[model samples]
Target chain A: MLTVKKASRLFKDGAAGFKNITFTVQKGEIVGILGTSGCGKSTLLRVLSGLDHADSGTIHLNDGSPSGAGVIFQEPRLMPWLSVEDNVLFGFKNPSKYRKQAAHYLSLVGLSEFAGALPRDLSGGMAQRTAIARALASQPSVLLLDEPFSALDAFTKMQLQDLLLDIWQEEKTTMVMVTHDIDEALHVCDRVIVLSGQPGEIAAEFKISQPKPRSRSDLSLATYKEKIFSILEYSNTGLQKYSVR
Target chain B: MKSKLNLIGLGMILPVLLIAIWEAAARLGWIESYLLPAPTVVIESIIEMAQEGTLWAHVSITLYRVGAGFLIGTAAAVFIGAAVGYFKKAEHLLDPILQAFRSIPSLAWVPLFLLWMGIGEPSKVTLIAVGVFFPVYLNIVSGIQGVDRKLIEVGKVYHFNSLQLVRRIILPASLPSFLVGIRSGLGLGWMFVVAAELLGASEGLGYLLVLGQNTSSPELIIASIILFAALGKGTDALLKSIESRSLKWQDNLQNAQ
Candidate 1:
């Protein structure tokens, strides 16, 4: 439900964050923007979420409005002074009316018992889950997540990926996630877009037709994983090494 | 609970021991009684003042002056601090002047204020306000400016207006520093009162100190000193309770231990 055309951004010192990038996301799709460090993936997400403006080109929502997008950063970014429940209801104009909905979302992220706890008291995984609940509380049409699980342990990361899929199925909200992990992108996304180069542009795109609850060890998924790795390696070597086993 | 009581008892041991030593020294003729009054003598002076109703009257007047000057000073400081913090132009215009004033000791202002406003209630109150103003103002400005930029980004993503950002993020984030400012301001307030009353007043604990020296009564001077110490401790304890309650979300100090 979102379209970004020829979007480009530059730093104040004239270095490119991203240049001439173009992409579109369909309704109810889970898209992963995968790249290595310094690939401008987070910057792209910021542009998409309207927190920062693109230096050139345009971004348009199909419905012609920009009000309904929720963003979660790598850090939970919860107001430490506010309790978990109040944080979830932070942006709501009528918090009392949405109290039930906030509780529901918190329960969805398995933080029902932690509603009164401050952000400092929560574990890393629990704080990230609370952030997820907060984003979902607004019931936005689009949710943008920027390396949200990077700091979490592997077990917690897997659990959050599964939780995210469950929420996606239930809410059917479009999600755009930025990640550096290959398996994580393959595990959670419907489509993966790889970005490369100093001034990043979309290097390649892949569609996964795998069904829900896809197993990581599945034989068929290996080929897709291998293909993605070769594409990444080729991009890294400037297409000098094309061999793929 | 028992451990807490034990801790308090441990704290009292040194003070009690010192008082006992002083009393013994005075009674046994180990020290001159005229220079340092015995504990019993100070207690008798306190009782005498209580009976004559002078103790409560002096206390009330001192409390009134401190309360008025502290409230006025703190309110103005917070306002100016917010303004300077939010606007670069205000900072440029006001910070230099504030820095210059801050370098001058609170006692140094006593003479200038007396000359300007005369040795009345006005000069005394003005001196106390000057002492209270600097710490609170500096802390508030630095606190506001130091708020994390990442948090401000969150506000932008949520579409919060400038007013909402200030109320929700800036003020609460700066609260710890603001509270610190208030505590220090109160301490300086007490010091300024004593300096003000040293010259101008006919009442207050400070006036009693000078009166004791003039009349050669060590008991009155010691009693006044004790009152000042008690009042400072009591107010600081009150502020500490407020700091802990308001910043309950901070687990850093507890977790560190």
Candidate 2:
């Protein structure tokens, strides 16, 4: 579980990244932070993963271990020099000890056949899957994904979404994903938090309450989609008004 | 494998044909023998040197100097380059001096090195070291600086400490450029040997070149020149093999494309 209280970050050029952002994620929950471009979603994820600092406020991990966080970037970001298996084992102090766990994670991501393959030799989908496997192999209590599937094609994105759902169900690991896609947020996440405006702040939060393996075309998701769309539209208009004034 | 062999064979045709033409032109007296010695005469000089055991002696000495200087220079460059690259303070302190030195030609260092170290092996080795140092140092620094910041973030996210990050991410990411530096440094290392031996004692292929000039034997000069070419090619081939092997991952991706 993670708790962030009134977190804020400001750029050196005096622009705010995010302001007074407060949220708590429970254990094994899949939460999606939805935002448009420049809404500081990725910045928030970076702060949560401890890759960057917050200028103000605090993030406390109730899990007690700081190493419990594993992050997957928008890009796969695999080490080009390493084999798929080695990449999965990259975070381990002694890789050989966790060799079986790495293999298992690779299989979980459906990339066991590519254990010896280099990152460059993989397709985009395969590379992202390998990245997911790498994150899982570290056995993090919280997996933070920053727009992980946005670069992927729609078909591949759908497959990855399903795979993520499966992994969350099976592994029971908490996940906080930053995404721009409304349907993607509806499709995969147990809860969705929308961020909006300049110097972004959390605008709305919605709990899906839909059962696992929910359909993209399901009538239940359409209303949630419409609500998220209106929130985005209102935020855009608000920004336009502020800029014009 | 077969295609690779065919490509090599195709590459050899021009060189082989040129050698034949030179041999024929020499035999036909198209050029005077003293001015441009016959290919056969060059071969004979090589055989004569080999018989006298001086050929191996010179080769061994030159190889030893190149090997020693190259190893020392490359090791120092990697260390200093990594230091400067990883620390802002190191870069601030050392980069300006290095950049200034980088503009000075390798041969220009020879006179100063000789004056300081004396006209001995130390001077020769130091000249070669200076020649080998800059390329490796500059390339390593640039290579480390150019590594993707995203990859460094991944390292940080994974809880890698500074040393672990450098060892796992920084070094391997910069390896391709570092190898390039090694290849170029070795080339300069060979070139500096001539400058080193030009003023010095009585060993190495460069020494043989001076001996050829003193004795007025065109055959000796040609033979020494040929040996330089052969040795340069041989050592380059060794580094090339290492480069290709270490960069096999990149090659696999290219092949897939």
Candidate 3:
């Protein structure tokens, strides 16, 4: 479980980045932070990953600490000098001790054949998969994904989405993902939190309630999609009060 | 493998053609052989010196000066460059003064070093080290500064301390640039050794150059020049191989082709 209370990390006289945002995520739930470009989605994720500090307010994981969040950025960001397996073990202080775990996660992400290969040798999808394996190998309390599959082709993106759900089913890992893709958010997340406007704040939160193995072509999802599209379009008009859930 | 051999064969064409032309001109007496020896005459002079055993003595001492200076210069550069690169405060304090020193034309340090350390091996080695320092230092600073911030963020998410970040991330990330610096530094070391020995030493390939001038042996002069070229190219090739091996992970234009 994770909680962010009144978190704000704005810049340039509050014209950029997120402000006064608040949210919580339950254990084993996949929550997607949906927003357009420049909505400070990344800024919020940085705060959650502990890479940057919130200018005000607080973020606490289950034990009242901010340490156990693993992040998968939009780019693979793999260490070019390291092999795929070594990149997975990068979070560990003693990598040799976690060799087995690295292999397991590599296999989990379908990258077992790439263990000895450098990041350069991998295709974009494979490289991103390696990054996912890397984050999983660390065994973080919560995994924070900042548009992890946004750069991939549609088929690779869909495959990874399904792979992500499979991992969720097996590991029950809590996740907080920031993404601009509406369908992607709908596909993988248990809950979707829409953020909008300059100095972004939460605009709406929707609980999918749809069971696992939900169909993308399902007419029910189309209704939710249309509703989300209206809220996103409306948010673009001007800064407005956050609508009631 | 065949392509690699073909590339080498392509590279040899110009040098071989030039050498052949030089031999023809000298043998035909189109140029005064005493003033500009034929390539064969240079080779013969080299062989004569080798038979006399003085060739190895000069070559060994020159090799020693370059090797010592390279190690000393590279070590100092790595230490100081890493410091200046990693810490903003150190960069602010140190970089301006270092850049100023770098611009002074390292040859200007010769007289001062000679005055302080005298005509001993120390002066020669120190001069070579000074020559070797700047490129390595500059490359290292840029290399560390250029490490992708995103990768450093990855380290930060893992809660890596400053030392761990530098050791595991910064060092390896900057290694390609560091090696580039080292290759160039070795080149400058050879250059300065010639200057150092030309001004002070009793032996070394540069001394061979001086000996030819004083005794009017154009063959010896050409021979020493040829040896300098051979040794310089040999060392550079060695470093290039190392660079390619270590940077095999790079997904750059070179690897793509």
Best by DockQ: 2
Give the Å shift of residue B47 in candidate 3: 2.0
Best candidate (score: TM-score): 2
Residue pairs in collision within model 3: none
Question: Taking the candidates in order, what DockQ does each have?
Answer: 0.71, 0.77, 0.77
Candidate scoring better on lDDT of 1 and 3: 3
Q: List model 3 lDDT by residue over A77-99, tens digit each.
A: 99999999999998888999988
Off by over 4 Å in 1: A12-14, A63-67, A238-245, B254-257
**Model 1 per-residue lDDT tens digits across residues B131-233:** 8999999899999999888888888888989898898889999998999999999998998889888887999989999999999999999999988889888
Docking class of 2: medium
Error of 2 at B9 (Å): 2.7
Q: For residues A31-129, could you state the per-residue lDDT of candidate 2 as single tens digits?
A: 999988988888899999898899999998877444679899889999999999999998888887988998899999999999999998899999999
If the candidates were sorted by their lDDT against the true structure, best first, what order would they fall in? 3, 2, 1
| Model 1: colliding residue pairs | none
Who wins the lDDT comparison? 3
Q: What is candidate 2's CA lDDT for residue B217?
A: 87
* B200-227: candidate 2 lDDT, tens digit per residue: 8688999988998998888888899999
